[model samples]
Target: MQLVTSVNSHSIAVMLLTVLALFLFTREKIPLETSSLFIIVALTVGFTIFPYEYENKELHSIDFFSGFGHEALIAVCALMIAGQGLVRTGALEPVGRVLSKLWASSPKLSLLLTLIVGATLSAFVNNVPIVILLLPILTAVSIKTKTSASKVLMPMGFATLIGGMSTTIGTSTNLLVVSVAVDMGMRDFGMFDFIFPVLIAGSFAIVYLWLVVPYFIKERRAPLMDTSPRVFTAKLMITEESASKDQALNELILKTDGMMKVLRIHRNSNDMYVLPNSKTIIKAEDMLVVEDTPENLKSYEKILDAVLYSSLGAVDEEHPLLEEEQQIAEVIISQGSKLNNTTLSQSRFLQRHNLIALALHRSGKKTETVLKDIAEISLKIGDVLLIQGKNEHILELKQSRELLVLDATSDLTHTKQAPIAFFIMFGIVAVAALGILPIAISATLGVFLMFLTSCINWKDASNALNTQVILIVVASLALGGALLKTGAASYIAHLFVLSMDGMSTTFMLSGLMLLMAIMTNVVSNNAAAVIGTPIAIGIAQQLNLDPEPFVLAVLFGANMSYATPMAYKTNLLVMTAGGYTFGDFLKVGIPLTFIMWITFSWLLPLLYNI
Candidate 1:
């Protein structure tokens, strides 16, 4: 094979376009999908107008669009749906329960376990769902234990990132890197081919996240109030299977450590109500009137295996208060609102709005009486209501001027199908790990089973496919392919080699990884991986060495997306939930970035004996 020593016009054009794309990707003013589409169109038009000639064959314009239907894209989309199945079916809820119990026993040990669990789950599951499952659990834990959420969330999020690097299907970025390497005429890597080096490097990263990172993160208070979050009054109906079904009221209170305050118990079977006392025995079909924050209300529902019922009727198993499509949110009755000064029964709230009124809250108000019927209780201005409905209905309510809706909306879990989803995910991993099929085929099969088993519907599956990620992967593939085909990658590689002339392979590897680490934090990690991979291979070729070690360097470096919140979606999630500032990310991410970079810089050379 021959290399192009001098950069040509085509190479210059591709290089310039790559820079423009990176600029647009990082700009908050422009949407990412729009920028990705623009790159594809620009590449197609540029190549069509001026065809690049190589070995008596012209590079066609249609070739650039091949990434739309690429195998890597198929695998990525399939895996996303599979991950969604896990989330929608609440397959990870059991893990949340275990973590909750662990946190109650010991906070310090819990953080370590949380980091380890987050990392372990991310090694096979997508990082997004792993974080999603743990987010609410940790938030509830923070409130219950009176700790700053900031101390735990950032560390947990970064730990999942470290774990994502350990496997091929751990993240979409890894998939793109491996797929691109295979396309570049390298031997295809197995699922666990590069796991050893990543695991060795990730172990140190995880330890840092568990111990030092939390101390660097400052404590931030919850939103809208400094002393306490808004509290709501809700009724918890105990069913036959509830954990507190036959327990005494005093025992249940002791179990929660007095976190749940029961005002009254209404036994519908006898149409009798009683004030909660130590000797009061809770039976099936009994509704316990409780007061707590919206988060705690939901948390206690899980703890007691009870359902939050509306004032109209007791929610039984047959007609559940929550479904997979429904979501719970908080809305405040504002001035001049339609429901202002009107009782729920008078306003016909549930019928008119297609929403269920689950509970009511008044600032600094507590009732000592039975409060027999909440539906007849007069609503007042500045009162808060806990509501449940579909997403579209919730959005509709948000648009209304009558109520001030809060930013929090939580999805109700569907635990019935959790086992099905777990088995489907397990089958996908097992098949791929055993070399029975390519990951693309195995993951696609798992998605098909998910649909057949009704783990997820078509609408949810389609929603699971991220348009931004799809467009970015497609356009980055086009740009990376263009660079390689036009000798732009080789030209860049040669220049890099000249700059580090007389340096050892170890030093060149370190430099390349550091460059990629910086680039990944500022741009899309997928873009960094796609563009950096070929340059890494080219540099290895220039040095007359195997390309495996250099390619691994690119893979590891591109995953170092820890230094900025904009670098990854999970960071943004934790930022909003933890109320963290940009400086907080820099406070923790910069040192953690260098930690992994330095570790891999030394570790990779030794592992590969470069």
Candidate 2:
């Protein structure tokens, strides 16, 4: 009786910690990595401070930090590097172009194509990089078609998540399951083990997305009137002391702000020079004609201390400047962008890029407040930036990866190493697929080749990695190990089985899957998998059933974090991009979650013979 009571006490303590971890994860009040680290420390200290005997041994003192070197964890990092190589080489551009052309005519068609392509690529590659690469291209297409970006972007992200579940290499979750199974002396899964079930699930998902998701989602339309207006106009003055005094007016405009137009520069005695080249110099009392909004005019006034002039009275008969010389373009924020959570003023976007934000569009709502003095407006994905700048400067800014240009101009002069990049990418994929090399080895090799071929320099390659993501993965793995070593996982599994006794295997599977889905909503999916895998294995051992189905159920369930915006990284990615409310996910996700649960519960036992 004493032993039973002691066991129960230990189990309760561990379960409480697990619950605490889940609560922290779901709230997103703390970073996932930080939450995981705390869980690990708590478990370690609990075990040491209040030791408990289990199975004739004191509860194992967990070396929670060793999961940093886990092979599955290392492979994920390597895959990220490989994906970076592919992006740097411009190898995916042709694929993106072909996809764009196929879906050019309709929003529905575009969504379907994006789903298909995203699913196919995610099966073999990392989903994170795939989504990152496709996001810009999809945004570009939305601009071209004038379609509400909200309609297709979320579906694209979901497609990648689904696709990642289709193959062993599709996501780290699949690989983690296989690794754990191998460690438990179970038959190792081949590369295509998940192909059949995934095909069925994926097919149903695609059809559902095409037929059902559209009906459920509300269409967020752009304004009928072009709320994106070019309102900023300013005048630039060239003085003897000005940095651009001796520079050509055109060159000076380029160097200063592309959005600022020099209507005319007058030397002494009203000698007006229009669009002067490098030879043009400023004499004393030289007046330069420039056009921008009042706020931008003020910025120019502050930056160059130039005198503000009223808007030029129609440089041409039609407007203030030639149509070819000046125009408006829309720019969208992207993932890993330095601009996320920053304001326009703080970003120095106007001062540095020479573009003025005339208006802002978010979640189908338009704001024309000029955004000059507002410092608290946080930039998010899918926020449209209506910028006014010269045609040449707009093109230059468009070329940058930080912002996706929404204008309808194609500039193909930028050189890209398409063929070499393709070959390198292919080599990496082939090596990993054939099992000739592990993904990490092949991916590292690919990164080196990228440098060798000059496909991407070191700076670009480094930018592709998300350090926070890597740290979260490592920390979660360590925490998961601590839970297992401290006997916390076994304790939870025993209690779950006890409470769920007399239930059918289907009921048990459903319950476990639902529990995992809930846990993932609060914590990292990888952490959920690591902690859940062992408990699932324990449950299977007690039930005298095959562990594969339960393990796969846990893996699949961990990824099905659709009910909350904080559930998965991809969920958060689309939240701001889609202008989604927290309630929005619950509206769409609850049904999807049920569908997946039912599909997997029925399918797992059949496939694995549990």
Candidate 3:
């Protein structure tokens, strides 16, 4: 293969466009999806304006579009669907429950356990799936422990990255480096060949992320001050199978472990009311009203397997409250509305609009009254209603003049095939770990199983595809290809090595890793690894030194993509979820990347005896 010089007109234009794309991404003045599309257009036009020859083949516009269909991007999109399957079926909820118990006792212990789980699982499985699996569990832990999600989410992401550096199968970046080395006539790194060195570096990083990074990341999520978040009212029916079947009212309260309070009890036989005392024994057909969030309510409802009742009569299991498209929104009954002064049951609100009132907030109203009956809740001029409905009805509220929808959140429902979904997820990791199939093939298979098992429908699966992440990754790959094909990266690599010819061999190795580290943060890591491998071999041959240490340097430095969110996909995932800024990555990532470089520079020479 042949390469073109950067002095060519097309190469200079590509470099200029690369710098502008970086500005658009780092400044974040526009959405990533839009910026990425602009980059694609720039490359397409630039290549068209000035064609160049490389390896005796002329560069064409089709070459630019090829990035969109890269294998790495396809694998990531498939992993996201597998993640959605785990979340949809609530397959990991049991794991979350155990973590919740630990978090209730100690936040530090819970974080340690979470980090351990993340690092160990990421060693064998890909890092992306590890983060996806732990995301919801940590969220539940955060809610239960009353900790801000910002504190733990980054540590979780970093843990997986460090672990990925330990094994070839850990991440595609590591595997690509090994494959490139093998193609260059070097032996492939065995499974544990690099684990010891990586664990040495990872140990220090884990401590910094666990103990130090949290203090730097302040809680950014504002506490929910609006009453809507806390307005969900749950109606739990007492059954003969209930543990508190015949227990006294006070004993039932004592048995609940502060889960909920029994506002009132109703007789199931006829139209009647029962005011119970400490000695009052609960009956099998008793109704209990409690205030709880939808998540907590689901737990309690599942524990009892009892029925839920409303003033509209006994609510069936098919209600929107438990549907995948179920949503809760805060709506204000507007002025001059027919809903004013009329109860929900009287207005036939569910019948008219296919919506149900979960709770109502009337400020300055008396607090001691048992007003859990959403059906009897009367609407007022300024009263806020927490409404629950399917997507159709939730969107329908926007068209109604009588109410104003302030905010809304949709709930996801899982299928009964949770066990199958969980099995498929486990099988994907197991097959890949055993080297029976490539990760891309195993993951692609897992996605097919998700659809076959009914874990996710076709529409829902399509919605999981984030075109923004896909396009940005594609555009970056194209830019890296442009750099390599133009001989830009190779030129820089050789020029630096030539400039440092007078330095000691150790110093040259250090300078090489440092360059790879910087380049990895700018371009994709796979590109950096591919570009750096030949440079490492060339430098080692010039110095009459072993090529192994320099090759290892390229591998380690390429994985140190910590300086920017765009440098790594896992970082981007956490960035969006944590609501982080570019400054956030610079805050901790720069120091860590520096540490990794210094650590490798210091340790590699001692281990390889350069």
Q: Which model scores highest in TM-score?
A: 2
The TM-score-based order of candidates, best leading, equals 2, 1, 3
- Per-residue CA lDDT of model 1 for 458-534, tens digit only, reads 87676677778899999999999999989999889999999999998899999999998999999999999999999
Assess candidate 2 and give its TM-score to the true structure: 0.78
Q: Local distance difference test, per candidate?
A: 0.80, 0.66, 0.67
List TM-scores for all candidates, in order: 0.73, 0.78, 0.60
Candidate 1 least-lDDT 10 residues: 222-231
In terms of lDDT, the poorest run of 10 residues in model 3 is 222-231
In the range 140-214, model 3's lDDT, one tens digit per residue, is 455545566778877888788878888766766666566556655787566678888888888888888888888
lDDT score for candidate 2 against the true structure: 0.66
* Candidate 2, residue 249: how far the Cα is off, in Å: 26
Q: Which model, 2 or 3, shows the larger lDDT?
A: 3
Top model number, lDDT: 1
